[model samples]
Target: MSQLTIVGLGPGPRQQLTAEADAILQSGQPLYLRTQVHPLTADLPAFTSFDSLYEESADFADVYNGIVTRVLATLADGPVVYAVPGHPMVGEQTVAKLIPQAKAAGHTVRVVPGVSALEALYASLAIDPSAGLLILDALTVTPETLQPTLPTIILQVYLPRIAADLKLTLLERYPDDHAVTMVQAAGDPDVERSETGPISQIDRLGWIDHLTSLYVPPTDETVEYEPDGESIDGMVRLVDTVAYLRSPEGCPWDQEQTHKSLTRYVLEEAYEVVTAIEGDSPDAIEDELGDLLLQVVLQSQIAKEAGEFDIDSVAARQAAKLIRRHPHVFGDQVADDSETVLVQWEEIKATERAAQARVLDGVALALPSLVRADKIQRRAARVGFDWPDVQGIWDKVAEEVTEVQAAITSGSKPAIQDELGDLLFAVVNVARYLNVEPEEALRQATMKFTERFHRMEAAAKAAGQDLSAITLAEWDRFWNAAKGR
Candidate 1:
């Protein structure tokens, strides 16, 4: 088989380069360096560099692809030695592509490890990486993708523009005054430089290049989850914790919980999540949302113990349903708008429930009245049982209002209650036609009223007057002033 040898050139010069990597470089085989811009590449034997590809290509992805294509083509003639800065497997996108392609084509590929930037970073910072360290590439990471609980190392921060971008991304999870360390050409004592300052001023440090990496210490007072330890670590830990809680020797309270009994906690966590979102705090929302997910996990665990179904089955059923329902997204169906998509979704659901006798078969009776009214109308509309236009909807509302007045005048309590319910249902229909959630709209309106009433009371107290003693005219004036403010 044809041979491909991938080698690491260490973080900097000859002093940092490993003996095996040095020997591979000195071998007479045809040599290729990812870039000639590195300090040690100048001292290596005569070789070709892919640095020129970076100039000709539009982006790093194109450059990496071009390098892989060129290397594979060269392997057709004879064995080739490919060298890259730092460890080949550490943040080297090109080698990741080359190894898989080479293996699939029956070429034997060898990876020669050398000191990576991570080693130099640890030395420069004098910190123990054994506890928890997250290494990420500067090009592909953003604020949303960052896990801020662990100390982080951002590699290949090779441009001022990238540094500026990284600064902004970090500021989302970190304070502007948060300190960060910049380690350049680590392990080469002569050329190495480390600077520490606020993340906001990282771009101003000057001379960002290929050998640069940024060290971000964990921010103080961060209330997020503990170092997810690793990517799958959190999930594994959650599963284990839940299993332990349900064990015989575990917490008595947790042991007593059944799927049916835990339903209240599920509803409470959902409302808490909604409250956190309304508060507009991302961290609070993230935390509360995790609590909501815990309820799902707990219920699933209980179901598993009862031999009904496991979490995997729950996930599989949900995924299958989503794909089956979203024919436009997962299949070759064409839906132009959300209205068309929803219609198709309802049709798919109807097909799933073909054995049911009623058109409103799947509408949950346990839902809030406003939401339930909306769902009933949606189902009726699907079958062309809806009003002709907005005028018809308004006329229905008027009719319900008049019926409520007649019932009130007749002084029949049950009739009055029934007519009032009809009026509310009609109002919910109006909310549905206007594409609004009646429950949330009413909740917000009630909150506004409460705030205004409190403000009027405060103003009355400041004026040395009691609200109970105020006349109706004076109360109206106070309410209008509160509304104006």
Candidate 2:
């Protein structure tokens, strides 16, 4: 049976290399070095023979497999020493691959632990592994795959060839100028930890070697990789990110934006979110809802900067209002059905407002006229003042429509305005009798008319006729044809 001893060579100098590892390397057995780039490789004890098949293999796994093959073939009778950089248990990929392979070959594998890069990193960075530490390979994974619950150091830089990839992956979750360090040869006097510029400048094909690594200082960039099991709230992360974006050090444009400036965007994103939901695409809805949520956070961030409020206040206000309005949910009130729920909600809302002062205050002027009129009429009707039947409202609408026509024929703009207001008000009352939201109904109708009218315009344009040059009769034909009137 073959026996394999995996030895760690510390970070750099022979002084720091562990005694156990030193004893194994000095024994007269076949020796394998994962890499010769270590600063203290010159001082490691002379061996029976030396092999460096690990560093030469372009595919690292191929190198490990070859090593396993050679060791098993040689170990038919004897034992061997395989020396790896740093602690054998740390970010050493060869050791990770070697254990399973050796076991598969019926060979007993022993790991000789030595001072790892993390030991030097912790001392240099003033940290403890138990406090929060994540060791990763810089070549295989991105910073987006990192956990941020504690301090983290990515290892196995091997070469600057992977630096660019790491940098690009890191930039997604970090600011461009985030100060990360390039750690090389930790623990040894040659140990260097340079607080480098943004990750963008690190090169994958440059001077980086096996000893190279990076340190990302703690940030609120929403870490996706949770190495240690911990729950992260997405909403909190989003809120924090938004907070930073609106901060002075964040985006200048985002900082300058106002709630009003983002109004249309909020509306558009909200509608897009609803559309994505209706489309039954969870991924699309997630993306669109994220966009919609951005508006909320962005607005809150702006308000915070202006000393108005932040996301917490925004959430708390909404939550408190919800609790206050939802008596059926949290209070002793009871509502048997949807209609009763609606009635209770309105009653509670009106009562709350009445505690301050009450008038025809159910609707604000900012609402579109038709909608406002409808709500005002409804609120008033709840107090027992409304039309006895739908016909009364219909007659009022006809009378208003007639006055508007008569005023147009008489060519008086002021009279036209008065009659138009009356017609709109009457239509709103009629809409209430029909149990439709007048605002939504009018908006839908307006959109329908707009769609057909655009077709009429396009048709006229295609025929090379200016709208002003076209007579009412010609316009009527195009509009009728466009709408199938």
TM-score of each: 0.49, 0.46
lDDT of 1: 0.84
Lowest lDDT block of 10, candidate 2: 223-232
Tens-place lDDT per residue, model 1, 1-485, is 68999999988868888898889889889999888888886687889999888778744556889999999999998999999988999999899999999999889999999899889889888889899988888865655467677899999787775686577567656777888899888898988988999999998878788789999998674423333434334654575467568775578999888777887888789889988998899999999999998988888777655444555567768999999999999999999999999889878988887888887888887677877898998778878988878788899999999999999999999999999999999998888888899989987998799989999999999999899999999999999999999
Say which candidate scores most in TM-score: 1
For model 1, state the Cα shift of residue 415 in Å: 2.9
Worst 10 residues of 1 by lDDT: 223-232
**How much does candidate 2 score in TM-score?**
0.46
Off by over 4 Å in 2: 1-232, 267-288, 446-485
Candidate 2 per-residue lDDT, tens place, 1-485, comes to 77898888888888888887887788878786766666766776664322465445533445666766666667776888888778888876667777887798788989888898888888877777786677777744544456654466888665544564466556555666766777776676765645566666766335576677787777776434442323335775575566556554688888667778898888789778866875799999989989998998888766554435556667768999999988988999998899998888888787787854556854666565776788888878877888888888888888888889999999998998888988888888888989998766765687789889989889999999998889989988998998994
- Candidate 1 residue 317 Cα shift, in angstroms, is 1.6
Sequence-dependent TM-score of model 1: 0.49
- Candidate 2 Cα lDDT to native: 0.73
